[model samples]
Target: MTISDILRDSDYSLDLLEKHIDDLTIFQKEQKSGLTPPYTVCKVRKKEIKLTPEEVVRQLYLIKLHKEYGYPYERMQLEFAVHFGREVKRADIVIMDKIQPTVPYIIIEVKKPKLKDGKDQLKSYCNSTGATMAIWTNGKEIVYYHRKDPNYFEPIPNIPSQNQSLKDILTERVSIDDLIKIDILKTQRRSLKNIILDMEDEVLANAGVDVFEEVFKLVFIKLFDELQNTRKLSTHLEFRNYGESDSELKVKIEEIFAKAKKQWGGIFNDDEKIRLTPSHLSVCVSSLQDVKLFNSNLDVIDDAFEYLVNKTSKGEKGQYFTPRYVIDMCVKMLNPQEEETMIDTASGSCGFPIHTVFEVWRKIYKDLGIEESHLFTAEKKHERALEYVREKVFGIDFDDKSVRVSRMLNIIAGDGHTNVLNLNSLDFSRWEETTKDESWQDIYFDGWRRLKKLRSDKNSDKSYEFDIVMANPPFAGDIKESRILHQYELGKNASGKFQTKVGRDILFIERNLEMLKSGGRMAVVLPQGRFNNSSDKYIRDFIATKCRILAVVGLHGNVFKPHTGTKTSVLFVQKWDEKLCPKKDDYPIFFATMQKSSKDNSGDKIYVKNSDGSNRLDSHDHLIVEHDLYNHDGITQDGIAEAFLEFAKKEGLSFASGKCESPFDEAKYKALLDGLEVIEINFSEVLIDKNIRFEAEFYNSKIGLSDNFLYGDDIIDFV
Candidate 1:
């Protein structure tokens, strides 16, 4: 089988396979030689060698470097040895200097998908070979980087052309918007999560401490280092560089981490030190020190955590990171205004809450109409952004790791990590269990004080009143525990007795509703079965009694694919209100179904590409994907959410700020236009929906005044 066939047969991620196939096919087509199985011709070696899985990746990249990147084949070698500390190791592929063929210029490590972490080996090779530039790939994900002096590897967006110098890659900066445009990001990119996973593989797997806790600690220290080295008004982050030896760097890093621990409080022991050996800790510091953490958005961080945790931990619980574009559409359709209190009940990585913070900050940042490059310090934007987060935004998750992650994102979003709590959303009755921590009380006292004002019970926020709520609660398991089931309305029978089991999402529905105030809006993703299953009618009834079902927008089946293909829908509702959601309930409801949710039938994401095969970006520098679910990005010719809003306005839905207009006389209008033919209409929003419609016939004048006679007293002369 060809190299492409091997990757495909491996059953690795389809996205990874597709990317490798594209790169490999182009290289193979350039060769006019033996590419078949028994022996594959090496374009550089100018001879046929046994085709192995590792050889496939090496050969494919060799052609890529030679043909596409303009690296001369004469400078490339099949087996290049470098002297490690005690032994000489051969890298899979190495490129030599143009003038000095014996000196290594670039080193590449190629492996298969199942080989979990190749970064450490690549780092070692680069260090030993004195090759400043190196690449690590597993025929799937690739990381291209250039090592700075003294052990720092800064990521390069891509490998440069032969004529392009390495400095060319370092000078360029990518925005979060442009970063999302790279579909290959999921396939061949380096991230903080990958580094953590690498550490787990190389060090923490045998370390005595919990892997999650240790990774969290390193990340915490890294974040603090980034914070301490902030640029003007905290506009940017500058990473620490070292000229010291590994042991010296270890001591210095531990000192910095200790300072961070004391400042952050509660997450770790006050005297906590780096748990890994000095050499391992030094290696990690060197690997991570140059990465610009704040250059991109939180989605990058979330992708890392989701990837690292999914394999060993969260995947079994059916919790996947919600794609950012999906979260953006929900935020757009919901239209959260500034200062609105919001909460995400099942806040995995806090995407919904954090994006809502982004939405609000965008408005506040632009209200003056000034175009500033960066926002928003905890003290910038009048510190209103931080105030809004502290008082108005909240998130909760039962999982400690998830809660810690959720808190990290919020802390970066604003100085409001305390707003995120680690309580079981479904078991609100025992929320005191989380609140009882005196340290938790110390950090969260102010935010909890604001929350207490909304509670029906002064002591607990079980009946808390939030203006808006959005969540994608976990539903992998059933609530078989009787004590947990006893609290939810969905856990009961018609006779008011508790049932032995209930879906976790079913209970989330009850708890989420209880959290909202009268007239508050909610947009939540639920399994489509909850909307149509015969046995779930009671769940629907429970919702109906508590709120007005304003909209039931059926999400495309592929929306959550490659994660869980169970069809789901975002059910939008408003608690029954005297003005917004009527108790009488005869009003017209907005209905829509997503035509596209970015991913295809096989769950492979199809990002729009340019003629040169790069991701197509937007005016805002965002990588534009096929998100026809909403008109927020204008990726589609027309969107269902956009059309539904127009329909809601025409139907005079109260929540839509709809105006009642004069009824149209269809027969009279048709008769008027019958002879006039085609008409152009323009709706004026400034006026009360009055617009011009004209039918111009070629047989007559454009206006055709004679055919359109109105014999009024003022126009008596007009016949």
Candidate 2:
């Protein structure tokens, strides 16, 4: 049987054991009776063993120890016995000391696949035999630890080779180049989310402190430590633990955190301090030291922050963070230019604005002809891109924790200045009262001043003139307070009398439209009911009056799973203007429905795979999530966004060039043009149509096509 067959229905993976397959396969013996599975000879014990799932991991780890780490067979022992007061248990694998063959130097455990179980067993073995190091793996993720004492176990990047000492591994000088090569996230196939979960099981669950605050502090300090060497490549990183006492390491980390707060202001209070104990801090730092936070995208940090925020009150308000892939699709469909100003009205973690920054940076690099490399995210070479982020991009949110996370991410993208503010977008009347506080002025005054310059009217906060707006506002509850509801036209009934309550997302639809200029465009995520339900026709009517609908892409039901399953679709529109978007009574709208969810039923991401059934990595050495919304930098197939781009060009949209081309014969084209007449049927006139529905599925079903059908120019012709 193949290795994959042997490891099926188990928690083990063959990712780390690929190299040793040929070495072990030569000794495989097939059963003559054909009634039992195959077996293999162990390299260390030189005896035949049944190739069960655990045995496969044990045998492959032995080969890695000998080949990669330079350990010899003479120093390694399998099932070594350990004695406790008249009780004895056998260890999985142990590397004996150099001078004394009976003493264990490094204890490796492969029996338990889960980290917590394996770690607990390793601790017992180390405490009994007085071993200084321990190792744990299940053929997917590997962690090395140094047993500092009976009470503490600190994680190390890697174990020393045969010629090296423990001090050699701890005291090695590391630069950013070293970090890029050895980032644990890539090498061990571990994500930041999994690392945080490990930390919680190790210490944070009972640390008597707020888990979010402590983790945020560590991440803030670690980011600062990496930024110090971004431009200067040879500088040594200061975020590691190098054989120092717990108290000394705490002092050093605290000093670095202080510097981070000074560098990125408004994230924390001036008097704030790390509350994790010295021992707890040491364990946490060692776990995070080997990870590279900056990549071509900040998805590593974004995933971790989403988990932390969701553990608190973020879910109760129906404010799940937007997935990065969705943000990318919106940005690509909009085709935001370098000169355009963008904003996210209900910015949760600022995904739209930050991705906009990346999109603009891609354009700037093309204009300057600067070829991007793997260091694109970490390097600060383009001054124009930084200038655009500082001056043009903006985000606003009411949640304080989310605002801090948004500001921190924006600061990293902009190199210092951030236009992200903590404010309520719907309640514009209270902004003046809130901005008067001296403490608020200290942090938000500069951004507030810049925002006032974009207002269409200086005397009121009701309207602004931004080029683009994108948002996924909260949709769970209703606004019962008449004070907030009175400001929105959607708050009124058919007779123009204000209603007592309205859905929160309904008001944001009006609020987002008001923030755009005459020719500006926007994309907003709304519930499917808003487009199909007969009771919500007034909401659709209000939208059709102000702008020309561009496109509507229906999302899968699993897009926001493990939280809520409200089916949603993105509504794209552009305000009518004399020059950019002339008023049109009859226009064809592009429609599409997504097939691939990009996530499984459990809300975990499903990565693209190669023909050999191995996970696929992009050009940046990151796993690619399988989806159909858009092509991911050429890694995925061209999808709906690409189809819409072609349609926009054919329709002569303002952002796209060229006019519609005909496929008929030259003589037939003349006859068709002569017979055509200009037709004007206002969209509002369709309010009385009994079968009216704005959803893409409702339209696509009428054409006898499935959601997964490939769309191109011919599909637009059919429309």
Q: What is the TM-score of each candidate against the true structure?
A: 0.71, 0.91
**Top lDDT hit:** 2
**What's the lDDT for candidate 2?**
0.82
lDDT for each residue of candidate 2 in 98-208, tens digit (9 for 90 to 100): 888889999999889988899999999999999999999888788889998887778899999888899999889888889988898888878898889888877788889
lDDT of 1 by residue, 1-719 (tens): 44445545552322233343444432232346755344566778777676666776677778678767889888888777778667887777888876677888888777535334456676777777788787877654676666654345544456667787666754444333333344233435345666666556655666676666666666677666555544233333322323445577677777877876676654566767777766556556545554445432445466567765665657777777777777876776566767578888889888999888877776666664645342233223446666777778888777767877777667756753457776778877777777778977876666566667778678765687788899988868888989888777789965677998888888888888888888888888888778655467667767777886666666667877777888777777889888765685344444445655578877666666665344565543434667665554454444544444444455445544312222434443333333322222111110111142343232134543232211111111100
> Highest TM-score: which candidate?
2
**Candidate 1 backbone collisions, by pair:** 142-188
TM-score: model 1 vs. ground truth: 0.71
lDDT of 1: 0.63
Model 1 RMSD to the real structure?
A: 12.4
- The stretch of ten residues in a row with the least summed lDDT in candidate 1 is 710-719
